[model samples]
Target: MSRRSSFVLAALAGALMLSACANTVRGVGRDVGNTVDATGSAVRDVAH
Candidate 1:
């Protein structure tokens, strides 16, 4: 295959993989945020 075609195929595959990862990335972010919040709350409780 030509270089241009190979580049396009690679870009398309990367885009698809990134799109699939978007949701899980968001969920992971939320999970981390929640965990941090819980830890902060626990620390506050301990301090108080």
Candidate 2:
């Protein structure tokens, strides 16, 4: 393959990996937020 073609392929692979990482981070953030909310609710329930 040509050098240009190789570079393009590398760039595309990097972009895909970066996008996947972003999605994973977003999912983790949501999971953490949900856990925090659940914990708060449990605390309030116990207090009441």
Q: What TM-score, over all chains together, does every model reach? A: 0.60, 0.97
Residues 1-48, candidate 2: write the lDDT tens digits.
Answer: 999999999999999999999999999999999999999999999999
Candidate 1 weakest lDDT stretch, 10 residues: 15-24
**Residue 10 in candidate 1, Cα distance off native in Å:** 11
- Among these predictions, the greatest TM-score belongs to 2
RMSD of each: 3.3, 0.4
Q: What is the C-alpha lDDT of each candidate?
A: 0.98, 1.00
Clashes of each: 0, 0
Runs in model 2 lying further than 4 Å from the true structure: none
Off by over 4 Å in 1: 1-17
Top-lDDT candidate index: 2
